[model samples]
Target: MDRTDADGLFPRWIAHRGAGKLAPENTLAAFELGWRLGWRAFECDVKLSADGVPFLLHDATLERTTNGHGAAGARTWDELARLDAGGWHSPAYAGEPLLRLDRLAEWALPRGAWLNLEIKPSPGTEAATGAAMARAVEALWRAHGAGESGGPAWPLLTSFQPAALQAAQAAAPHLPLGLLLDHLWPGCWAVARGLGCVAVVLNHGLWTAALLAEQRAAGWRTLTYTVNDATRAEALLGWGLDGLITDRVDALGPGQPATA
Candidate 1:
């Protein structure tokens, strides 16, 4: 598939976990806050609940963001839904519930927001989680993609787990896939190529002009995450990097030409 068109699918500056520290991460409130701050693109993480429902969340446990305890993947959607996802952030957001991926799709479908969905599988359920998440994404777009019901742009599916990315590829090859790397390693390029990924997301420290050139030379786009400083963001953009996922949605508004 010629996925070069996917290059134009995103902006240079993406809101990290939906406005990052501005609101409770991965909650609808966060995404809403990002939207209010002029973010047109966002990055998020997703995992399967005990009952196999896909939901937006980053950690393996719910203690950090929710009022619930124990492993997040150990609970059903109903049980997870009962948790207070925003109270831990502040009493101002006391009643936020676990955000389901489908519900998120519903919000984005009509709004034209671009999402970079990170396939964050639980420790032992990598393949299952990836397959399930991909299926849900495909179903959502099929029901809402452009010219069908006039949906927003389709999302880009990316992951750090090879098994997860592989399963997503097997389940939905038409969706743009990106391989994520926490650290640079030997044969990393081969791993991404093997999975048929069109892009590669890396930790900010791994970004370099040479690295960007190498990826470009091999016909792939390079993006980095959690960048919060202006100097580093400028340096990376100067290096010809494709995108920077940042927590500072406040500082890096979407109105700028680079972000536009």
Candidate 2:
């Protein structure tokens, strides 16, 4: 897609991990909360279960968010689905089951929500995770008729792992991809270009006026993550960022003023 095509597909404000810090991250409950709060674009992490089912999760282990132990990817979808994924956040969301990507697609596609699926792979499973997730997303979008006939944009696949993004590109070249970076690692830009990425998502602190200008000149969209402060958000927007993935869903969103 050209820049204009890409522009129509994405929004300026994307809710990080669904509802961000409000609800359990990467759950349907969080997504619903974001939707209610007027966020149409969302960014979430995706990994493949041992059974090859793609699901929403951020960490390699389940200890932080879910009531489970050990590697999340080690569990099959059947096993992972039974875990209480919300109680760690609060009592009201207790018993919220782990969400499969297909379920999320079923909910978001019909509603025209844009998604940025970050391919978060567990150790030793980068290639498998990327390939599986690409296939899953492709099938889901095809089934729902998304990104066609003027529907919602196709979900963007992003990752910190070059191997994973490479596998994704091989699996579904039609899908748009982005490279995630925490810093300007050597050869990172070259890798992103080689992978045919349309954008680059960076840590909020990594952006500068000069960097933004360079990226714009290079014809790549620029986005940053986890920005919650209104003052900082204002600065980034003023610098012409394409998007901001923020945790302050309740406070910062489309049409909401940037307040301190």
Candidate 3:
């Protein structure tokens, strides 16, 4: 898919984080685990390090997800990189390095995996994080020649924060964006159109056959997140869900099932 085309902005299925439930979430090991399972597309969160480089992390604080204890953005990549990011998940994954977005892009591009980069800023850094991440993505896209003079699929960026979405659009107007909404909002379609979003990602709870039909009928691609149950996933697929972000990529088929 060309970077300019929204038609192929997403993949059939997205592993929640590298391997979702199969490995420690958001670590390089987990991503590789997903790759091992024949999955090419995955979703991961990106947050700015203290020096503004984008790095993979799912929380504002590193305590819960990694052995490190502190605000993720408060520490420079050099400092955060030294901490054990995978030990808490299990002894088998003690030294998983913090994944730089640039490195992840390098790794994923060769294998043709579509990335869904969720911009998750620290509490007050929405605009900054959004702008920074957008700039970073733009630079990477340009460097990789992901523009019209392209090679492979550029990542699809999404976020629940409108400010972040706006910033991303401004930073790289050409890069496709998606609106991540947890519920049906008033004029939600209008909002997504205004932001130039290529897709609408809903919280798993609010999804239904009716809503899916409504969005699909309107020519909008719809996706759900964090779904882990096989039966529910099958049901969503039957309802014509465009895609899913799941954790159990290794246990499921090629698309990888949802993560909890």
- Best by the TM-score measure: 2
If scored against the real structure, what TM-score would every candidate get? 0.94, 0.96, 0.91
| Candidate 3 residue spans exceeding 4 A from truth | 1-6, 255-260
Clashing pairs in 3: 18-31, 246-258, 246-259, 247-258, 247-259
Q: Residue-wise lDDT of candidate 1 within 1-260, one digit each (tens)? A: 10113447556778898878989999999999999888878899999999999999999998898988999999999999999999999999999888999999888767878889999988999999999988998898788864354455668889999899999989988788899999978888899999998899999998888888889789887888988888888888878777789999888646654443
Model 2, C-alpha of 71: deviation from truth (Å):
0.7
Q: Give, for candidate 2, the lowest lDDT window spanning 10 residues.
A: 1-10
lDDT of 2 at 248: 95
How does residue 190 of candidate 3 score in lDDT?
A: 93
What's model 3's lDDT at 86?
Answer: 86
Return the candidate ranking by lDDT, descending.
2, 1, 3
Model 1: pairs clashing at backbone N, Cα or C within 3 Å? none
The residue-level lDDT of candidate 3 at 28 comes to 82
Q: lDDT tens string, model 2, 1-260?
A: 11222457467889999999999999999999999888888999999899889999999999999999999999999999999999999999999999999999999988878899999998999999899989998899988776578656788999999999999999999899999999899999999999999999999999999999899889889889979999999999888888889999988876578621
For all candidates in order, the CA lDDT equals 0.85, 0.90, 0.82
Give the Cα-based TM-score of candidate 3 against the true structure. 0.91
Worst 10 residues of 1 by lDDT: 1-10
> How many clashes does each candidate structure show, in the order listed?
0, 0, 5
